[model samples]
Target: MLLALDLLGIFVFAISGGLVAVRNQLDIVGVVVLAMATGLGGGVIRDVLIGAVPPPALDDWRYLAVPAGAGLVTFLWHPAVERLERVMNVFDAAGLGMFCVAGALKAHDYGLGPAPAAALGMLTGIGGGVIRDLLAGRVPVVLRSGELYAIPALAGAAVAATGVELGVRPAVVVVPGAVLASGWRLLAFRKGWTAPAPRVSPPR
Candidate 1:
């Protein structure tokens, strides 16, 4: 179940990365590189932080194949894929939820306490997008888009981590946790909700 969720999340993220590459007019190599980085970067970061060396993404050939496949498809059919941008954003929200929950659960399994596990989970949710944005030479959406992205991710991670710490079965917690994150993200997207930013006075 976890492996399947991880791959699904990777596929979604890779597609997003591919789309971004196409939008930027990058060549096939850029498309593949961005897709791979977006799909695997987060898990790799989480694994390294938690001392899970040779991260599953690095060791698993399937992981590599999935993102490569996504990129290739997006590259070949970019116009059609681009037309589904709105739908893709919805899937991206779902992917965020899956990654956050998976990340938290993995961290917990690796002996991290609730707080750190939740933090890692949030990182896992946002890390791929961050890497993709940097490679594309743009500001990360999570940091500057004013969208309610990270908060929902953190909320979901906190719930999963805390629920597990309270002795709930992981299997029982996963779905609701994912729903919480993804539902919130989708709602924010639909409603045009934005996170509050610091108010600035006019420059003197």
Candidate 2:
């Protein structure tokens, strides 16, 4: 179940990456590279941080293939894919929810304390998109956009970590945790919500 959730998250993230590449007019190779990086980058970072060397992504051919397949599909059918931007955004939120919860559980399972595990979980959710945006030469949406993205990821991670720390079953926590994160994200989108920005004075 966990492995399936992980791959679903990777596939969604890869599709988002491929979409970005297509929007940027990147060639086929670039599309695939970006997709693979976005799909695997966060998990790789989380694994390395927890001292799980030689990350599973590197050891598993299926992990590599999923993103590559997503990229190719996006590259070939981008026109249709582009038309589904709104739907894709919702899937991205779902992916974010899955990764954050999974990351927190995995970190806790690896002997990390709740706080650090929660932080790593948030990283697992946002890290790939940050890398994708950077490589694509754009400000990360998490940083610059006034949208409720990272906050929900952090919320989900915290929920998962806190639940585990309190001796709750991980399986019991996963669904509610993911629903909280993704539901909040979708609500924010539907309600036209935006995060506050710092005030700036006009130039004299």
Candidate 3:
């Protein structure tokens, strides 16, 4: 189940990266490279932080293949893919939820406390997007757009970490954690909600 979720997240994120690369007028090589980077960047960061050397993304052929395939598909069918932007957004939310929950659980397994685990979890959810934006020469959406992205990831990670700390079965906590993050993200998108922004005074 964990592996499946990770692969799903990677595939979806890779497609997103490919789309961004295409929109930025990148070559096919750039599209594939960006896709692979976005797909694996977050998990690699989490693994390195936890001292899990040679992260599964590096070790597993399937992990490498999935993102490469996604990138190719996106490059070939981008117009169709672009037409399904809303559907892609839904998949992106699912990817965020899965990554956050999985990252937190992995951190906990590595002896991290709830707070640290939750922090890493949120990183796992947003790190790929950050790298994607950077590679595409844009400011990361999570950092600049005031979208309800990181908060929901943190919320989901917190729920999973706290539940496990309190002795809940890992399997049992997965759904609620994932649902909270993804559902909240979907709601925010649907409602045109934005995170709170600071008010600025007008220049004299």
Candidate 4:
């Protein structure tokens, strides 16, 4: 199940990456590169941090194939790509939730403490986005400005930790918490709901 989730999350993130490439007017090669990078970059980083040896993306060629396939699908179906805006947020939310929870749990399982594990979770969720934005030369959504992008990831991590403390199985607790975060994030995006922006008093 976890492996399946990883692939599905990769597919979702890959689609988003291809959409970004389309928006940028990138060529097929560029689209494939970005999609693969966005899909696997975070997982690679997570594995490296936890000392997962060669990393799953490298060990399992399907991890590479999935994003490349997604890019190809996006390229071949321009109309479908055009239709993605309606459902893009849903995919993004799902990727974020799954990656964050997985990252946090992996970290904890590797003997990391809560704080580092939580931070890893956030990194797992947003790291790919950061790389995508950077490579695309756009300000990162989590860094520049957004409602509670990273916040939800952090919350999901905490929920995972709590579940661990309570002895709930990961499938029972972490998965639902991730789904909840994703759903909430989607609703927040559609409704424009966000954490209060930092207050900057009028200059004296």
lDDT score, residue 2, model 1? Answer: 66
Model 2 off-target regions past 4 Å?
A: none
Q: If both were scored by lDDT, which would come out higher, candidate 2 or candidate 4?
A: 2
Judge candidate 4 at residue 141 and give its lDDT. 69
- Local distance difference test, each candidate: 0.92, 0.90, 0.92, 0.81
Residue ranges of candidate 3 with Cα displaced over 4 Å: none
Question: Lowest summed lDDT over 10 consecutive residues: which window, candidate 1?
Answer: 1-10
lDDT of 4 by residue, 34-76 (tens): 8888898787788898998798688888898998998898878
TM-score-better candidate, 2 vs 3: 3
Worst 10 residues of 2 by lDDT: 1-10
**Candidate 3 — worst ten consecutive residues by lDDT sum?**
1-10
Task: Mark the regions of model 1 whose C-alpha exceeds 4 Å error after superposition.
Answer: none
What are the per-residue Cα lDDT tens digits for candidate 3 across 15-122? 999999999999999899899989988888999999988898888899999999989999999999889888889989999999999999999999999999999999
